[model samples]
Target: MILIAKIVSIDCNLKCDYCFYHRWNQNSNRLMSCGTLETLIKEGCDYSPICAQFIWHGGEPLLAGLKFFEKIIEFQNKYRKNGQNIVNKIQTNGTLINEEWAKFFHSNQFGVGISLDGPKNLHNTFRKYPDSDGSFDATWQGIQILRQNGIIPGIIAVINSANVIFPQEMFEFFIDSELKNLVFNPAMIKDDISGLPTGIVAKPTDYGNFINRIFDLWLKKDDPKIEIRQIKSVVHALIGGKYRSCRFKSECQKYPTIECNGDIFSCDGDEQNKNIRFGNIRQGLNHIFSSEIYKEYRRKIQRLRISCLDCQWYKICRGGCTRDYCSRSQELPKNYFCEGMKEVYQHISDSLKYYKILPL
Candidate 1:
């Protein structure tokens, strides 16, 4: 089954230092209305497979109210008779989570991921409410509510200079809190957008060192609950096809991303731009895969450039993340993710040698 992430709410309480969406307040978020959501889910279920994973992502999804999400679950459950299956997950900042939220989420068996930077010193360094109050206290309090309800929340740590030195500390915090299975994504910024540099532009070597540090802790630090950010791509590669796109195992696999408001994009992360958009939700899913817009996006993935074609790591890298490539560079030969992929590939290769998952 393919993974589908939807935006439940555009509203967010915190105005983080590097919020790429530039979210403002409760009103800023444009939530997915019930009509659009129903249509999308119904259409999405028509794929060959009966079971699918749905992830709720947003400026802050909880602001949409638990009732709205329940309605979605109910709708999907109704379609289960037709062999449609849906698994729920949410990516939130944890500010809105409380006893009620925890109960609903845990009872529903949703995988919840909270955005926390670590100790108060590091968390408050960049992540904060618009009023300039520190978010660590409120977020941790929310996490406490989840734990009380018997739901362990996974962490989504953005590696910034502010928190770079605290990776070990963060792992320790997770261990003490008894939370395991975390994702460590580096801070990402757009060239057109204004924000702090994404942790001082760590070159490949710096990233290699960072990976080594993480492995150091994972192997020797005695932190049983901690797992670094490798699940998504590694699992994807182990699974699918091979026409193109370095990101996916096979370009022919056709994992499409549907945006809120009836719009579709070639990919999820970089769909805001009109240029890359495919079709609207009103359109049937069948037509989108064959449309010119999709063809163009697919072609771009196939023919990235001479340099990309020649690179030894091109196939596995899948031309890197389009958002990171085009947004950070805004031009060719300057994908900011170049360094990151280099580090990831090298480390994974080294790791595989030790485990015999790849060539020695």
Candidate 2:
């Protein structure tokens, strides 16, 4: 479905090592009241087509409790002014997951995604509770419940520099587990410029290199159930097929993200970036287009940097997610990530000289 609405909740229990949100410090938001939800849905029904989705996202959505989510689903069930149909889904860290949440998911037809990195070490390296206790045991305990209940859990792993070299290990670890689907999102860091040091910036080529390594592993598998968002998007375009996407997929459309505190942004990538806020969720996403703050955000998306426009990778990367490229400024590029992509592409192309899986 194209028109999807995300119910955003801020404030998470876990504090990971490579947490960009913490680096940005945008997590001090509260619960979204029912009245705000009603107004937003009513406005969306006026603008969008019939097929719409209600995706619950958060610092930790389950932290809002199951009863709050139940109320949300109930609102979706009745919140129709025109032909808008809402399909409920949730992407959650499997901490508070229990039989109760699993049952609610099954009955509501919600697609469940769990945040799980590889084995305990790789996961604990970044993802852990605020108290610094490891979360693997509790997370897996919930996963086991979902498995027993016949609810398929989609896996989401954020790659840091350490695990970037081990695509085979990442895959084998997931394959050995019950996970049949996985999404790989590289770690995103911000420029610090805080006390004495600047933030750690992630280069585009480094991200590209990481993607290429995963592509290599994917080649080895006969029929991959793993669903990589970036490669799958490219493959969908190459094969002349269709694919599902959030607001981030297309350059033309700006997806709206509503925070629990009543702030709204163009998309999820702009979640913490201070420059993207446009009006309150009490108004509508339509306000984003009209608001002056969002105009620059849209402007940055439309006007490609001079160097990027001429680059060979532009067509494939589309400047590597507008929010990512412009998270710092409209002018500068993450030369590191871009160069890493080139290096990774060459490595893969060279490897293909000896081993060809997809017809070259």
Candidate 3:
């Protein structure tokens, strides 16, 4: 199971156009307290002593500062059970990272994920500071610092219409930047859920064509060091591996996110929807597991929608994200990216026939 700690609740340096936390009004002055951290660590240890992963997420987690993380490491050491292992990961907007931050991250063995939307031109289009100045230069500098410290940070790029048209350019940017690990998230615009003005959401056909072109580029590389998440996930699923993309997970609630105040949410994407909040750290895991929201989530997981079951890629996709379903209606609907995902999957499967990386 994964526990996402929204360490800083609401503070961020750059304002990315498609930021979900900002759109949902989830930002605040609230930050996780030491007592709350202790309680969370104890509860997590009790829940799974064998293995657990804690993802330090945020409005921008680094805003909590380096000392906060040092304390977290201390708490992890103090509470962790014998033979149990706890892995830590942080997802940040790369602007705050420096040599010291990189050193601490390296020494602590933290799996770092940086948000970079391709080249300067594309990245600056959406990711900017309060003054409306592009953060590309600062962010790129941070990425270079992390690399200098021997930390290969995973890159997460949100695909909006601005960058979606230039899939090849985006692909080459990552390759040229020497960024090997990457994930592209399609920007979602839901009027009912976000309560924000609709941004550029990629059309299914456009996204499919973009992915297909990138897949072709990915295949053509002779000694590929790059790992584009969407393609890699599809390839992994095709070969019958237990990959960890949430879209493919049978039960999304297994990975719950905890707010700075210790409020437990079913998932990060659904954090704004108060209806899905099961319980809090003080309530204990037993109480949370027995809550109505958790029970309902489990029920939904067990009973796959009829449309999803009929689809050929159902086993691999698992009907995609629950939040995507919640955006449209009360019932669990098929994935919003279903058509585009199918197109990418078919393209990869066809390409695999020639490479024969996995058994036929």
CA-only RMSD, every prediction? 4.1, 3.8, 2.6
- Candidate 3: stretches off by over 4 Å: 24-27, 192-199, 271-274, 301-304, 326-333, 356-360
lDDT of 3 by residue, 126-167 (tens): 888867899999988999899999999999998887898998
- Tens digit of lDDT per residue, candidate 2, span 99-215? 998898888888898988788877776788878888888888889899888898888887776566666788788877857687876666555542111233334555566678777
For lDDT, candidate 1 versus 2, the one ahead is 1
**Candidate order by TM-score, highest to lowest?**
3, 2, 1
Q: Whole-model Cα lDDT per candidate?
A: 0.65, 0.64, 0.80
- Residue 93's C-alpha lDDT in candidate 3? 87
lDDT score for candidate 3 against the true structure: 0.80
TM-score of each: 0.82, 0.83, 0.91
**Candidate 1 clashes between residue pairs 3 or more apart in a chain or in different chains:** 10-29, 241-250, 242-250, 246-318, 247-318, 262-281
- Could you give the candidate ranking by lDDT, starting with the highest? 3, 1, 2
lDDT winner between candidates 2 and 3: 3
Q: Residue 19 of model 1: what lDDT?
A: 72
The true-structure Cα RMSD of candidate 2 reads 3.8
- TM-score, model 1 to reference: 0.82
Evaluated at residue 287, the lDDT of candidate 2 is 67
Q: Which candidate number has the best lDDT?
A: 3
Residue pairs whose backbone atoms clash in candidate 2: 191-199, 192-199, 203-337, 204-337, 204-338, 205-337, 205-338, 205-340, 205-341, 206-337
